[model samples]
Target: MRPTVLLFDIDGTLVTTGGAGRRSMEAAFEKLHGRRDACDSFPMSGMTDRAIVRKAMHIIGVEDSAAAIDAVIDAYVAHLAEEVHKVDDQRYLVFPGMREAVKEARSRSGFAVGLGTGNVREGARVKLERVSIYDQFDFGGFGCDNEDRTELIRCGAKAGAAKLGVPVEECRVVVIGDTPKDVHAAQGVGAECIGVGTGTFSVQALLDAGATVAFPDFSHPQALEILLGGR
Candidate 1:
């Protein structure tokens, strides 16, 4: 059966942010909170931006406030621009076969593509546009709205179902991502999870997380074909 909606994670799934996210968080701490090492060793993989910022603030013993959060976000955006500029030949890379996969999925009838990521809406757009795939997604769930990854997946699934004029139960939702969190989120919503071992996690690790299928990478044409067919 054709999936009614395909929900994808941004980092480590479709593209690499070229370490922009880490640099941006570090800069945000330094510029807005007067802390230089707030994000020195924070584990950001598969985490929401809001969660990252909140954790950083907690580590620095700062009281959370809306104004402070907004300031940090602003600093992160500015820092992202600067960091992206300095990486001369090391810009973000769209994963191999991603273009073809997206093209084929989007071209199919009853198939709608959307994002289920830990990035905020604007950040998601920035990352996707950098890799020239922003236009492929019809809608997305943003980390700025909620820190829970499962909730974001639900939000994404709902949005995609809305776009397709289908009930959430009737929609064949597939979540494609790179981490255990992604698998957990997909399972939380009763969606199929496709884990790609393009990030820190190994294929076995993702399989342990209950991914429906785990692949080391989808760069191979045959693997890509199998993945597409399975979806």
Candidate 2:
């Protein structure tokens, strides 16, 4: 088997936190900016927390400075952890076959799993721990890694390659996600993208966004083959 690294996305791809993330983010903005709906119109798919904060600040007519953005990130992480615990059990959903996919990947040879998510580090941990699948990913690139989604994905791929004892250029890197942004980001870095429609977007939407492949969920009969075959 060739050296292969799979970078997975949290939230919509691996698990769904319902609106817990939004609520938490909103609370943070309200506390930091006195604007309860600062991020209401922000597009969140495949975006980094840093980007989100910056966008939200712009929308709310606040100064978008490095200092302000960092503050928002820090506050959002704290609020997100608190809100995750308060989320209803039913609201925290793990997509069907995703856990199986993750387990299967871990069991397979030449495969290293890591995260490429828009969420901040602590927020990612809390969200996954809420769904009890946090242990599957030991390393990842969070929104804090960079404001650019593509860069964050590359960061994850590099880290994954490091864990696999190979350079990223020598490995077949694939990004598995649930939104068009994921596909677009993969395209930016010339990597393969498998778009799952477990999020707000549909399969067609992802395909339109230039995903090489799109699926409704990981429960398809040939899901395992399709997922692993990206390499």
Candidate 3:
């Protein structure tokens, strides 16, 4: 088997933050700009924290710049740290079999596991640590890396490959995520996506979005095969 690096998305794939992320974002925006509902109108699923801040800023007639967006994200992470404690493994659902699947991938000779998530790195850490899955991932491509989903995925894959001592171009990268944007992101870099319908979209919707395979949840019987690109 060729060396494959797998990157999992955080929010809806590995574990649901159960609104802690949203509440944190809302709180941050309110504190920073005095706009209590700054993030209310944006389409958030699969979007990066920087993307969210940019969009929200645009909606509120604020200038969108690297420095300004960065400030918001910095604030967002701080607020997230506070709000994340509200979510625990008992309250947040870890998709069935995900932990074991990641373990299985780690044990395989030609595989490496990491994260490619839209959450900012710190926010992702907070959310995953609460769910007890943070230790499983050592490197990640995060919203802090890039606001663009496609670029972030590539960034993540490269990082994962580097950590495994493999060349990025030679690595067969598979992104496991739960949104159409995740599938589209993989397409942007010519990688395959294993889409799980643990988010807003259904399985068929994920397939329609160009995922190599789509499963209703991580519990699906052929999940391992699908994750490994065997199907």
Candidate 4:
């Protein structure tokens, strides 16, 4: 088997933040612009953190300048750190078998596991820290890497390949995520995507979106096979 790179998405795939992300973003907008509904009109799924703030600024009739986006992101992260702890435990959840899956992948030889998420590095840290899984992924392609999903996914693949001391082209890169955007991003980089239906999208929907395979969650027996086998 060739050295493989497994990139796991944070939100919805490994864990749900119990609306901590949304609330924090909303609070940031309100604090900065006095408009909490800035992002309410659009879905934040599969969007980069900077992109999300940029879009929300546009919708709220604010100039989406780089500095403005940074301000929102900084504020959002601060709020997220606090909100993650305040949310009801029932609403915050780590999907079934995600930890086991990550652990299993880590134990395998010739495999490197990390994150490929829309969250910027700091935001990713805060969210995963709440669930006690922040240390699993040592490196990633974050929203800060690029506003475009394809570019970020490519960035992640390259980083993973670097960890294995091989060219990205020589490594089999697999992306595990919960959105059609994940499928498209993996395709963009000539990687395969294993879509999970733990998000708003369904398994059939993910398959229709061109995922190599779709599972309800990592708890599915076959999920590990395809994840490890790269077929």
Candidate 5:
């Protein structure tokens, strides 16, 4: 097989934070700006941590400078450390077949597996550690890398290719995520995306968004083959 890079998205793709992320961000915004509802009802699916904070700042009428956004994210991470544990075990879940699929991919030669997520490094760590899956990925293109999902995906693809000492263009990159944004990001970087309907979006929705393929979850019979770029 040719060298391949597999980038996985964290929330909604591999696991569900069970509202811990939203709660933490809301708490952080309230702690800094005195408005708990600043983030209420905001469409946050697939948005970066920094971007979420930035939007909350705007909703609360606060100035959203880089330093300001950083402050909110810092506080959010602190709250997340506690929130991840607070959520009931049933609420926080690693979707079925995801861990096994990741293991299978990593065990293969010439396959570089890592994260392509919207969470910042610390946030990803806190959430993933709750389920003991944080160490599975050694590198990723995090929200800290770029606020734009496409740019971050590109960054992840580049990093994954570098792990095999190959130029990004020479390696086949596949993104596994659960949102239209994830699909769009993969397309933005000239990579393929395998969309999972583990999140708010349905498989058909992801397909409409232009995913190379879509499945209800990692448990689909043809998932591994499709993910590995086989028919």
Candidate 6:
């Protein structure tokens, strides 16, 4: 059956942010929390924004409450804005065959596209727009909404289902991402996950994480077809 919802991960899946996201997070901590030592070495690949922030706070012995989280996010936004201004060349690039994959998925009957990513709402928009693919996603779940990756996938699925006026349970959700976290999130919701080894993780790692299918990269048309086919 054709998937009713195609949930995509932003960084490392649709577009590559290089080290911009990590730099932004570090800048936020330094500027807002008055701690340059915070997040000196935190694993960012495939982790949610909230998870990253919470871990960074723990490392600095700071408590992460709702208010503190908001402040950090605000700081992150500010830092991202400032950094984006300084960079004359665009660093974010759309993954090869990503646009064609999105288009093909959308062309399929009963298919809809949305994002489930670790990026905050504004950050997600900024990155997607930087790559000129912001309009492809109809809706999304942001990192600010929740700390859990599974919850984010659920939120994205719900939003897509709502947009199509279908029941969430009836939606055939297919999650496309480049991390084990994404595979786990899709498994949490009993949805199909397609793992692309374009990120830090390898294809074997994704398979071990329980992805329905894994690819070295989506640059191949056959891989893209299999992924969009919900295999």
| Better model by TM-score: candidate 1 vs candidate 2 | 2
Residue range 1-231, candidate 3, lDDT tens digits: 767889899888998877888888888788888886988987688999888888899889888988888888888888888777776657687888899899888888778789999998888888888878899987888988888999999999999888778898889999999999999999998888999999889999999999998888878889997776676
Whole-model lDDT for model 2 versus the true structure? Answer: 0.85
- List the candidate numbers ranked by TM-score, top first: 4, 5, 3, 2, 1, 6
Q: TM-score for every candidate vs. truth?
A: 0.93, 0.95, 0.96, 0.98, 0.98, 0.93
What digit string (tens of lDDT, one per residue) describes model 6 on residues 104-173? 8777777888998988888887777766788988898778677899998889999988877889898788
Scored by Cα lDDT, where does model 1 land?
0.83
Best by lDDT: 4
Give stretches of model 3 more than 4 Å off: none
Alpha-carbon local distance difference test for all models:
0.83, 0.85, 0.87, 0.92, 0.91, 0.82
Better model by lDDT: candidate 2 vs candidate 3: 3
Q: Runs in model 1 with CA error above 4 Å?
A: 221-223, 226-231
Which consecutive 10 residues in model 4 have the weakest lDDT in total? Answer: 222-231
The residue ranges of model 2 lying beyond 4 angstroms of the native Cα positions read none
* Tens digit of per-residue lDDT, candidate 5, span 68-118: 999989999999999999999899999988989989888888999999999
| lDDT tens per residue, model 1, 2-99 | 44778889889998877887888887898777897887766789998888888889899997787777778778877776676555445678887788
Q: Which sections of candidate 6 miss by over 4 Å?
A: 85-91
Candidate 5 is scored at a TM of 0.98
Model 3: lDDT of residue 27: 82
TM-score of 1: 0.93
The residue-by-residue lDDT of candidate 4 on 4-47, one tens digit each, is 99999988899998889999999999999999999999999999
Model 6 residue 4 CA deviation in Å: 1.7
Better of 2 and 5 by lDDT: 5
